[model samples]
Target: NMIEDSEEDTHERYEVEILSKENRRIPAEMVVESIECRGEPGKLVIIRDLTREKQAEKELKDTQTFFEKIIDAIAEPVMVIENDFRVKLLNNAARELLPGNSETPFLCYKISHGRDTPCEGKEHPCPLVEVRNSGKPEVVEHVHQTNGKERYVEIVASPFFDSDGNFVGIIESMRDITERKHAEEAIKKYAKELEEVNRLKDTFLDIMHHDLLNPLGTAMGYLDLLMDTEDQEIKSELEVVNRNISRAIDLIESATRLSKLQSKNSLELEDINLREIVDRCIENFSYEASKAGMKIENRITQPISVKANKIIEEVFSNLISNAIKYASEGTKVIIEAEEKENSLRIKVKDFGKGIKDSSKQEIFERFRRKEKRSIKGSGLGLAIASRIVELHSGKIWVEDNPEGGAVFVVEIPKK
Candidate 1:
C-alpha cells in the first residue's frame, strides 16, 4: 500500500511539472526551498515582466527630463508655489534674478522687495494670493530693486489644476520691461523736441514770407506800368519776370499753408459734410488739372459726414495736385468715397508710375520724393498730408491698384 501511494504522489507531481513547463512559468520548487530557509515567510517574490516594466520606467525618466529642460529653457523667471505659498520649484532664471547666500532659501516675494521681513507674515501678503483666490491670472507692474539697480518687472500669476480638477497651486512668471519702457519714454522726449523745432521753423518761414510780400507787390506794380507802355521787347521781358514772380509767390503761399498743416498740434473739430469739402477741393484743383491736361472724376454719391478740421480740404488738394503732376498727360484721376460701418473711406486713384515696394514705407516721411532731383518740389507734400490726417484722427495708406497704378486710401472715423 505504501509503494502504491508513493507512485500516485509522483504521478501528480509530474503532471504539475508538465503544466508549468507548457505555460513557461518559473518552477515553484526552485524558489520555495530558498525562501523556506529565510526567517520571513510572508515576503513577496514577484517575477515582473521586465520588458514592460523597463519600457515604462524609461518613458517616465524621459518625461521628467523633458519637463526639466523646458523649465530651464524659459527666458523669463518662473516659480512654482504650493497652496501655502512655499516655493516648490524655481528655474535657473529665478536663481539668477534673485541670488543670495547658498545657505538661505530663496524667497521670491521677500527678495523682490529687498526686505528682511518674510513675505508670508508681512502687512501685505504676496500678490499671488489674490490670483489663487480669484482663480484667474493677475498681472502687476512695478519697479523692483536688486543689486543697486532698479528695473520694471511685470509679474503674471496663473492658477494650476491637477488631473482630478483640484486647485493645485499657481505658476508665477516675471518679465523685465525696463528696456521697452525706457525706449518709449525716450521716443516721447524726442517727439517733444521735434515739435519745438517744427514750431521754430514755422515761425521763421512765416516771418520771411511776410517780409518778402511787400517787395514782391512793388515789383508787380512796376511790371504792370511797364506793360502799359507797350515797348514790345521790354514788355516781353517784363511779362516773363512777372510770370516767374507769380510762380514764386504761389510757392511761398503753399509752403506757408503746408507748415501750418504739418504743425504738431491738435485741430479744432466741427461736424462737416465730407462730400461738400471734397467738392470744394475738386473745384480748387479743377483749373490746375485742366492746365495739366488731366481729367478729374468723382465717384462719391451720398453725403458722408465727419468731425474734422478745415485742413481736410488742403489734404485732398495736395493729394489731387500730386496725382495730376505725376500722371501721364490726359490720364483720368478718380476720387471715390464710401461709407464704412464706423469710418469713412476716401480713395484717390492715379494712373502714374506706381511707387516701388522698398520706397512705400518711407514715402510719408519728411523730404522723401520718388521723382528725380530735377523734379521741382520741396518734397514736403506727403509729409504735410500725413500730419494733417493724423491731426484729424485718420489713417492713410497706399496700395497697388488692379489696373496698373497706385491708390491712396484715407480712413477717418465717422463721429
Candidate 2:
C-alpha cells in the first residue's frame, strides 16, 4: 500500500511500502512527492529493465556496421550529393578518385567545375557539375588525352529523397570500360583482315577459272567436230560431252566474275539509264531463256537513272540466270522496276524453289549453299552479288513471293 499525508502547516509527504507473498514488509529506497498538490500528496517512482532494449540496439548497430563495410569495399566509385548540388558522402573508391584523403569531407567548391582554379589549382575540374545540374547520367568511351593516355568511363547519376519525400541528394556511380573498348577495336581489326584474305582468295580462284576457259572451249570444239562423223549412238555420247563442257564453262565464268567484283578496290561508277541496262541484260540472256522453255517479262517504268558500277549488269545477269536455271519449264521470270524517293527499287521474281526463312540471312555469306551435294556451284554468286550491292551504297535482300517462289529486291540510290 502507498500513503500520502499533509501536515497542518501545508507540508506534504509521500510514503510507499512493498509486501512479499508471505505478507512481510520490504524496505523502500526512496519516494517523490508533488509539490503543487499538497492535499493529494501524489508519489512518483521509477523502475527499469533494459536488457531486451539493449540487445535490440546492439543488433541494429551490427547490421549498420556490416552494410557500411560492404559499401566501402565496392570497387567502383560511389558518391552521394545533396539536392543543392553539394557533395554529401563518398566511399573509399571515390576518395581514391578525388584529389584528397578519405577523412576530408567533399565540398561543392572542392569537386565541382572550376574548382581547380582555387581548390586543386587547375584550369578544368570534373564533369560532375553538369551531371548534377542536369540530373542525367553521362557516358564517355575510350578518350585519348594530350598526355598520351586513354580512359573510358561511364557515369550514372540519379536523384535521392528522404522518408518524407523531401529532396535529399543524388547518387553517382562510375565504372571503367577501357578494356571492353580495346577488345571491340581488336575484333574490328581482325574482321577487316579476314575480309582482305577472302578477297585475295577470290582473286586467285578467278585467275584459275579464266585460264581454264580457253582449253575448255578448244576441247568442246573438237568434240563437236567428232560428232559430225560418228554413228548415231556415238553422236549421242558426244552431245552429252558437249553439254557437260558448257555447264563447266558457265561455272567458271560465274567464278571469274565473282572474284573480280570482290576486289578490295572500288568499282568504276557511271551514270546509266536503269531501263537500258536491264533491257540489255535481259536481251543477252534471251537465247538461254528461250532454250529453257521459259518466258522473260519486263515491267520497267522508264528512264530511271542510277550511279552504279558496270558490275550491276553482272548482278542482274546472275539473278536472271538463276531464275531461268531453277524455274520449272514454262514458268515466266518477271523483271520489274519502280522509282522510289531518292532511289530505284528493282525486283526479280522467279517461280522456283523458294528460300527457307532460316537460310535467307546465311545465303549472303560466302560459300553457303542449301543443297551442297546436289547444286553445281562454287556458292559465291549471291555472296558476290550482296557485296557488289553494298559497294554501290545499295542493299539487296530476298523475300518469299506471295504466289509461290522467291523475290530478290535490289535498291540503289538514284544519285
Candidate 3:
C-alpha cells in the first residue's frame, strides 16, 4: 500500500514490526520517499523505532479506562464540565438521566437544563461559575428538564484540578430533590392556612370577651336585684337563673384563657417558689373547700424553686380546685412535691371517687367531664392546666390516688 501510494518527491509512512539485533520483535515506523535519482527511478527508505510511544499510548488509554469505570460505579449522577460550559465526561447515571451521551460534544447547561447557552439568572445560577469564583465546593439547586418533564436536583460542585494543581473545570454530583421540593411547598401552603385559622380564632375570642361576657354580666346583676324579694318561689327560680348565668360566664372565660395559652409557643420563665404558689392556691380555694367540708393539706415542705412563669400558679389552682370540688365531703386534699434529677414533680391528691384508667388521658382534653351531673364545673380546668404546663416545658398526667381518689401529677423542668 505504501509503495502504490508513494509518488516522486512524496513520502509514505507505514507501521511495521522488525527483528532487532537480538532477534526480538520491535515496533517501527517505515517512511518511503520515491524520487528520480539521475533520471532513474529510485526510493529512499527510513525506519524509526515506535516502542516507547506505543507503550505510553497504551498506559494513557488504561488510565482513562480506570477513571471512567470509577465514575460509572457511582450511584449519583456526576459530570466533569469544562470552564467553557462544555461537558467533558459523565458517568452512567448522568448519561441515563441527562441529555446527550458521552459521544456528543454537549454543554452542561444544554444537557441538564435543555438550554441553548450557559445557565444564568437568579433562579438557575451556574454552579461552575460559583466554584470557579470561590475555588471551593458549592451546593446549589437547579431545575433539570428532560423529555418535557422537570425535576428538582441539588448539585454539589467542586473545582476540578489537573495533576499539576491547575484549575481545569468543575466536578459536580447531582442528587434528585423533587420529592423534598414538593414537601416543602406543601408545608408552606399548610403554614399559610394555619395562620389564617389563628387570625379567625383571635377574632372569635375577642367577640366572646366583649359580646358574650358583657351581656351575661349585665343579666347577672339584674337577676341579683330581682332576687331581693319576699316571694320564695320567685327567689328560688331567680337563683337558678343566676347560677346558670354565672356558669356560662365561667365557661366562656375558661375557653378564652385556654385558647390564648394554646396560641403561645413559649413563656417568660422565672425562678418561682413552688410552695408559695401551691399555698396561695390553697388559700384562694379555702372558702370553697370549707363550704364543701373538705380539708386542704399542704404536704410540701422545704422551699423548692422552678424555672417557670407566673401563669404556672393557674395550673396548681385548677388541680386544687378540682380536688376540692369532686372529693366527698370532709375528705382530705393533699398537695405534695418531689425533686428529681432534671425536673420537679408535684402531686395533688383527692380522697374521693378515683378516675378510671380509660378516662385518665381524655380528662385532660377540653370540655371533658365526669359522668355525674351533680358536679359543677366549666370542664376546661384540667385542659387549661395542661396547656400551661406544656408551655413551661413541663408535663401533666393523672394517676390513681392510693388513698381512694385521683392524683394529678405535674412535672416541670428545673432549668
Q: For each candidate, what is the lDDT?
A: 0.74, 0.70, 0.88
Model 1 has an lDDT value of 0.74
Q: Relative to the unseen true structure, what is the C-alpha lDDT of residue 264 in candidate 3, on a scale of 0 to 100?
A: 92
Pick the TM-score winner.
Answer: 3
TM-score of each: 0.50, 0.51, 0.86
Which regions of candidate 1 deviate over 4 angstroms?
1-203, 227-244, 328-330, 359-363, 369-378
Cα lDDT for residue 203, candidate 3 = 96
CA-RMSD of model 2: 12.4
Model 3, span 34-60: residue lDDT tens = 877898988989999999999999999
Off by over 4 Å in 3: 1-13, 16-59, 99-102, 230-232
Tens-digit lDDT track of model 1 for 1-415? 2223343113222111112446764322211111323555332222323445556878999998899789989999888876765667777787777644322355555556755753443334465676766889977665666677877777788889899978877898989899988999999999999989988997888776898877888889888877886578988888788877776676676577677765557888899888888789889988978887788898887887799988788778877878887764438889899778899989999887887888876888776877743334556778778888988889988888778678888889887
Ranking by lDDT: 3, 1, 2
User: What lDDT does candidate 3 reach at residue 245?
Assistant: 87
Error (Å) of candidate 1 at residue 86 is 28
TM-score of 1: 0.50
Q: Output the worst ten-in-a-row residue range by lDDT, candidate 3.
A: 369-378
Estimate the lDDT of model 3.
0.88
